[model samples]
Target: MIAEICFTADWLERKRTELGGVDPALLERALHAFALLGHLAESDLEFVFKGGTSLLLHVPVIRRLSIDIDILCAAPAEVLDRSTDGKNRCGQSRPACQVASD
Candidate 1:
């Protein structure tokens, strides 16, 4: 099951200790990246998560935190438009996902 990202002081403290005094802002950015990733996963889009952030999270040898997410969307850009359900958790219209040009 995919977990939702919730911000709390206790979460911050735990991360700070776990990551050896990494900046709180960077951690927050990471949280946002995770949230976005979770949203993407819940959608119908097909993607492969990769890059520095992926390594930092999954590879124990990488001790540094990355502030961004890098994903390769396997589906066509038009599929992204059809997949979004409009309203998000915040009741705002969800923005269309953009696939980076190679």
Candidate 2:
């Protein structure tokens, strides 16, 4: 069964008006992003949710809609030190950083 998260077009329109002209399409995408987060929670990967999206979700007063998803891995540094095809500045391989830059 597909769980609902108030992703109706009507709700998007209403929210767009409430936020003083946020795009309904963007609002819908944001709802989909939250749905993805729900799925992520059920997975084995551990992470700490953060950034503007987190603030908008948790803090009612923050009316600005942020489409970005920022998260911190719960894994230890050693666990994160996997070899990668890319390298960051200072010529050190950072998988997470490389992925973000891509």
Tens digits of lDDT, candidate 2, 4-68: 53666677787788878887877776766565555445445577888778887667574677655
Candidate 2 structure, TM-score to reference: 0.59
Clashes of each: 0, 0
TM-score of each: 0.70, 0.59
Q: Please, what are the lDDT tens digits per residue for candidate 1 over residues 41-98?
A: 7776678889888876667554777766788876776665555445543113222333
TM-score of 1: 0.70
The runs of at least 3 residues in candidate 1 whose Cα sits more than 4 Å from the true structure, single-residue gaps closed, are: 1-5, 82-102
Question: Once superposed on the true structure, which residue ranges of model 2 sit more than 4 Å away at CA?
Answer: 1-5, 74-102
- Give the alpha-carbon lDDT of every model: 0.65, 0.56
**Cα RMSD for candidate 2?**
9.0
